[model samples]
Target: MHDIMFHKKIKKTLSTIEEVLNNNNKNIDFDYLLLDNMLEITFSNNKKIILTSQIFLKQLWIATSNQGYHLLYKKRTWICIRSKKTIKKILKKEFFIQTNYLFKLNLLNNI
Candidate 1:
């Protein structure tokens, strides 16, 4: 996809995530910052999750405490190239591990 299209997609996805988190802030306390094409989520425990879009690669990259995942748009979903897992699934799992709370994200509506 073109740079503009990729940026738009990333912006929409980040906005959706922010909305969801804001609506559920009582249950999950966190702060988020959107800088350029990146979203940085900081949990109450000081754990951080970063989501960044690579325009040239046309991929979304997610970084957590222990590892980083590069997700490519494929089959109507963003999936990890090595694990073949969806970004939403990975995020849910990672968030739960980091916060001991389930991360419920409805990516279908945004994507």
Candidate 2:
């Protein structure tokens, strides 16, 4: 993918996550901060899950307190190259592990 397209996808994905976190359920267990190409999610227990765009590698890097995953955009979704999981799956699992809450990531369905 072109660098511009990769950046756009990253931005859109991050923005969608932010929207889902803030709008859908309003879970007080966690809050999110979105940067240019990164998302920092802090849980009430002080654990964190980070989503970073690696433009140089054309991938998304997600890190939780206990694990990390690298995902590449494929067939309109970001999928882990090794695990073969979608970004939504990874984020959902990590969010639950970090916050003990299930996030309503409805807007991210298309990503």
Off by over 4 Å in 1: 108-110
The best candidate by TM-score is 2
For 1-111, candidate 1 gives per-residue lDDT tens digits of 778877777788777777767766777778899888889999889999999998889999999998999988776668898889887788888888877887667753427
Model 2 per-residue lDDT at 74: 93
Candidate 2 regions with alpha-carbon error over 4 angstroms: none
Clash pairs, candidate 2, are: none
| Clash count, predicted structure 2 | 0
lDDT of 1 at 1: 75
Q: RMSD of model 1, in Å?
A: 1.6
What 10-residue stretch in candidate 2 is worst by lDDT?
23-32
